[model samples]
Target: MVLVTGIVYKQVKEQTCGISFHRDTLYDPIVISRIRPDGLFASSSLAVGMQVLTVNNVPVDDMTSSEALQLIKDTVGQVSIVAENRTIAVAEAVCVNAAPLVPESRQKRGFIILKQVEKSYSFHGPMTHDMVNLINNNLRQLKLVHGANMLQFSLNSSGHFYGATNNAAQRVHEEDFIVIILETMELLGWCLKVQYDRSPGGWQKELFVFHRMSE
Candidate 1:
C-alpha cells in the first residue's frame, strides 16, 4: 500500500536540510548517505539506510539517480519526501508526509524550532573558525532567553551533521563545530540557547520537544 504524509508549511527560507543520498543498487531505496548540519529536513527519524519511496507523493523508484536527485533538489515549500526501510513495512516511511513534524516560525518566533532545507546549497568548506564565530554571533543575537524557545545546534559527526541530542554518543570531533553550550536556569524552567548548523550536509530532526519536558 502507498502511504501519504500530511502537507506542511514552509518554515525557513531555505530548507537546507543537510541530507544527501545515493542509490548503490539502482533505485534500491535511495540511501541517506550524508546528513549535514545544513539539511534541516533530515531528522533522527531519517536515518542512514532509510529508503526514499517518493518525493511529494510521486514515486522515485523508476528514475535515474541523477533524475531522482534533481527531483528531491527541486522540491519546495512544505513538500514531502517520503522514505522507508526496505526490510520494514510500508507503514514506516515517516519521511513521506513531513507535514506534522515540520515547524514554521513566521510572524513572531514561536516556541517551536523550524527546519530549513536548502536543496541547491553548496558547502562553504571545511567549517572554518570565522564561520564558527559568525554562527555563534548570529545565534547569540537570537535572544533565545525570551521564552521557551529553543534551537538545535547541529554538530558534524564524521561527515554528517547530527543534532545536539544525538552527538553526545557519537565520535564527534569538536573541530567540526563551535565549542560552546548556552544554558540558563530561570523560574520559567532553564534557558536553552539554540543555533542552526549552517555547515553543509547537516540534518534537522523533528522540532525541539525539550520545552514540553521542561514544563
Candidate 2:
C-alpha cells in the first residue's frame, strides 16, 4: 500500500535500517516491515507484524509512505522510536562497502551482491529440493572470470524461477541456473545460505542476513 498511496519512501542510497515495508491500512497509517537481527532497525527486540506508528517522533498518521520514509532518511546518528509500548534505539550504520564498485558492462570487471536491501521474497510455486540441488551443482562448476556477478531472479507467472547474472562475462547457463547465479553472488558479499527448516510440501525456507564484506 505504501507504493500505491503515493508516499515518499526512502530507497537506501548510502545506509539503511535493513528493512522493507508496506503500509497497513487496517489501522492508523502504520507501516508493516521486517526488522532484521543485523541491529539496523529501531531495535533488536522488534518483531515482524508490529506496526510502525512513527519515525523519529513525527506522526505518520497523516503522512504518506514516502514522507515517512524521507523523515527516517533525514534523521542521522542516534534514532529513537516509540512503538508497541516501548522505545527503541537505532544507530545508523557507520560502515559502507569501502570498495564500492562502479556500474559497467558485463564484459568488464565489476562487483555484485544478491537480494539487495529486502531480506526475503514470497512466491507461490511448487519449487522442489531436486530443482534447488541442481542449481547448486551448476554453481560449483561456473568459470566466469570477467565482471563481478550477483543473482537476479524472479518468479514467472508459471511458478518457475527465471534467473540471470547481472554482470558476468558469459551468458547464463540454461541448466542449474539458480545455483550458478547464487554461487556467483557468493563470490561477491551477498548470497543465500540455505538451511534446514520445515515448510509446506517438503520445501525449506531461505534465510538471508545483510553484512558488509571485510577487505
Task: Point to the candidate with the largest TM-score.
Answer: 2
State each candidate's clash count. 27, 7
lDDT of 2 by residue, 11-120 (tens): 44224454433342334434433443442653444444444666666667776544565565555555444345222111111112323231222212222222222223
Each model's lDDT comes to 0.37, 0.38
lDDT of 1: 0.37
Compared with the true structure, what per-residue lDDT tens digits does model 1 show for residues 116-177? 33221112223323333434454344322222222334445444223332232111222122
Error of 1 at 55 (Å): 1.0
Query: With candidate 1 superimposed using the best TM-score fit, by how many Å does residue 78's alpha carbon deviate from the native?
Result: 1.1
Clashing pairs in 2: 7-65, 7-66, 8-66, 8-67, 9-66, 110-148, 135-179
- RMSD of candidate 1 to the true fold? 17.9
